[model samples]
Target chain A: MNWHLIAAQLLNGLALGSILALVALGLTITFGLLGLVNFAHGVFFMVGAYAGFVTFQYTHSFGLAVLMGALVVLVVGIVVERVVIRLFYRRPPEDQILVTFGLAIVIVEIVRAIFGGKTQLFPMPSWGMGATNLGFLVYPNYRLQVIVIAAITLAAIYLVLYKTRLGLIVRAGIDDSLIVNILGIDVTKTLLAVFVLGAMVAGFSGVIDAPIVAVDPDMGASVLIESFVVVVIGGLGSFSGSILGGIIAGEIISITTIWAPDYAQVMLYLAMALVLILRPQGLFGTEGRL
Target chain B: MMLRAIGDRSTWRVELAVAVFLIAFPWVFPIIGGYANLATRILILGLFGIGMDLIFGYTGMLSFGQAAFYGTGGFVTAYLLSTGMLHNTLGALAAGTIAAACCGMIIGYLCLRQSGVYFAMLTLAFGEVFYFLENSPLAKWTGGENGLPGLPKPVIPLGFTTLHVQSNLALYYFVAILFFVGYWVARRIVRSPMGAVLRAILENPARAAAVGHNVPKYKLAVFTIAAAYAGIAGGLLGIFQGYMPPDAFSIDQSGEIIIMTIIGGAGTLIGPLVGAGLWSYLREALQNLHGVGAFWKLILGLLFIVLVTLFRRGITGGITDSIGLFRVRRRTAAAHVEEAPAVSGEVQP
Candidate 1:
């Protein structure tokens, strides 16, 4: 009944969704291009957060932290692709899941071993702090910044994926991997780049959002599961689909928190279940992809 | 020979060997630095693993929500006992199992419609939902975070005397008997026509359905069966520990079960027992080791990576493969010697 409350919740949803949008872009690419559901993607997010955390400790620069986070995860992704994931490219989806799952465990456990089980604080830069006034609303300055950053990131990624030659092949590759392979595109290299790009954004999301949520080793798990939900709802591989899915999931979770907090997760799951039942391929997913 | 056509060879020799091992386990265990409790834990996991194999290995359905059924059954039995509603332990355990199976049937109805990763994700979501429900909504009966404790041990009455299964030793024997029964039943199921149908589904779902088999229906059936098995294992956990913790429904529990199943080998029924034993031993050893506080998981993770990449079929599969190879080599060698003797005699003539 309270219009203001609804508006506030909507705004809150946007802030929360910005983080998910960033993460989902990478998930969409991996799922869309490689036909993989990388469970370890979340681990990369955590690793990125640590990368940012350490950079901030030394340099006290948020921008530097974000860059370090991205760079660290990119390098890690390359090593993982070569050492572990490349072997699974030809294997079944389950094998890929299990391998990545094992990798996730290793990454998380190593982080935990180093950091212990405590949650670390990542302070928002002073410039990104404080509140913004919009006549009818007052929102945190950091959150508003998150919305803009997420938008910019999406635009950049969009351009990279569509405008660049490699991006075109990536998109075309999504259409038909076999055909793309026959074209002598070095599908392996292309997929490796895609994986690295995906990991970078995931790490960036972790660094950017670390200020909002506690930086913990196991922080990536819930986010990872929710991201999967987003991908499923948006259609598995469509970039725009995940973006839309992320916003919707954020709104559903944020709005439900007002009435019944416990039911929020349940509602998100129910929404996904309904989507799967009604449209298996998702809202933007190609038919038969399911 | 008659049963071999249906993939139902009795394999009494193997069964007898296992029975002997189970009987001799307690004696050999102490010598190997193992304990009674560890054996009991292994047997329970073995039971649960068999059910997991039915779904994951036999039916080719990767479910990540088995802990839901486990928690459901464990809580049901624990709640009944805590409230004094169930006097007979066996009856309570049976009730708990039925409850878990019913849940599986309902969850499977919605989940089975999705295949591959989606199926796994849906199950994971449902499992988390159950955990939240048990934690917040049904906390009154399930004991929330503290969990239900102080459960009464079961008593068996003989014609002239009554036996109380209370101590760890007694519980081990009781559990061992149940484990044997469970294994026997699982073996029967694996040999049944339904098991063949399941394996067929695992091999190729589209082909299995095209050949007039109802793949989804079979999937649901095996899914329910697995839930029942998990339910029993959950109930046994409460009985063995004398308390049922809410952790039975956790993702970690499900993950551990998956790890154990994989390490032991998936398709083989005995794989779980071996896996559980190995995992538990590793855990105990790692936990007790100095300088390693919580990083034992890292070691296990490394082992998991190696196994997944190099030894995907697992310990049991590896053993069986090598054994088969050895037999083939011996047979070929014998045939070669026989040919040499025949050639020499012909040349002399």
Candidate 2:
């Protein structure tokens, strides 16, 4: 094994895994709290990228772009939750999945209509340009920043979910929503908050990932699937599992690329299948939780 | 007696009506601006949607990886025919159908281990696995992004005469016969003892299991059957178009069929066909209209949301419910009239 190639791929995997973790984190939180599948979660990611793209075009400020991306998706999440998703709470899981799937198509088509089907270039911020020499290996500045951004966001979300009172209610709701409602905690507000929070996180990750990957209406499709694999491997609704699953998925894809690039994606699915066979709950998932 | 017989579930009224519609569709559809090709596409999707309805509508298993079987069947049949490895189209189609069914069996086995969202995600992920395999690793056979092109249309040889499906109309007839058969078979399954068990499972898996039905076995069987249906549809698509596109294995393909099934109404059997017709017709019609071409999917998506929210029973379900309500009202009215005359006669006496 070539140490240099392996090391580089490992780092690349970490970067990829971090993004995957960010995306999956949102999905787990929503699934845990609301029991909603949220198939349209990826559309929020795509929307964020487009919002950031439009923002960057005017302001040329990465900070503003990120903020706009998150804010726009947050609003979109609110309207979607209020108008459509709110009605689905009492429905079966299949109904929720179907509605959200439809929502995803609608959102993607709208974006395609506005931006056209062509891939848009999201140029790296001025500060994030050039490579960083990290003693043993050189890495792009934007990618390193992405890792930092994802890590910081993950930490921030952790604090909110664990340390805050709202987090307490959310976690309690996740355990047994009916009981939480019986205790007069107003689970509806919590559900909306958690759903929007998940959407914002997805959108944030989309914008952050814009420079690294192509920004297009359908860009979220792969990320969405990969995150599903991550959520599955980590165990659904397991917070730490998202992180672990994401890294493992990233490593699998990157490392496999060394020998057979085409099989990188196939390897990820195989790993998921293996995990399903060995531990259906996932690495960090609780049995029968979701 | 005749009316009651026609209304009976065992009666051939529904079948006769469906056959009439199938025969009249080609002629009547033209008045509303539909052609043979569009109708044929609808039939293909309708055929695919029958399996979807079985597993999803009646059995309550929502699988998003049906494209795996569809692509498998299409590619296998297309590859066999295009490469001259198979001379007979019917034989190739049979092989493709079997291949898809086998794939469904394996996939269903693993995916059935989980229920609800987990199952949906597993199926979707597994479907992607097939897509990636087809696009890159197995591109030699599948022809990758360009897809497998230049396959001959279907030709059937009997002991006496040969049938060549060379024209669009001929192909439509060929597919229509297969679709009718598929529909008839699906209707049988929906009315079978196993079908009752499937419905019971759908209503309440725990109760169904409590009643001594093998829920998993039923699910697996239906899932496999659905895959077979998808496979045959895929084979027909390849033969109809004379080229198999790689996107046949895509998530969109899987999603579209689901949309069609749901739009037409799940559990209604013929609901999928209605949904396919509406979906295909609208898509074709909308794409032709100025300023509305791109928005057709958007409109459909909105319509889907509305249907799922307000009309979960779907169009067919709604219509059937209304008809049943109307019959009940008429019977009640007649009973009241008869009672009124008897009461009046007693009072006068």
Every model's TM-score: 0.93, 0.95
TM-score attained by model 2:
0.95
Which lDDT value does model 2 have at A118?
96
DockQ (CA atoms), all models: 0.46, 0.49
What lDDT is reached at residue A248 by model 1?
93
Residue-level error in angstroms, candidate 1, position B188:
1.0
Model 1, position B276, has a per-residue lDDT of 88
Number of the predicted model whose lDDT against the real structure is largest:
2
lDDT of 1 by residue, B44-131 (tens): 9988898898898667788889999998988898888767888777878899999999999988988887888778777877787788
Can you tell me the CAPRI class of model 2?
A: acceptable
Q: What is candidate 2's lDDT per residue for A16-128, written digit by digit as tens?
A: 99999999999999998999988998899999999999999999999999999999999999999999999988778888999999999999999999999999899899999
Q: Cα RMSD to native, each candidate?
A: 6.8, 6.6
* Model 1 superposed RMSD (Cα): 6.8
Poorest stretch of ten by lDDT in candidate 1 chain B? B1-10
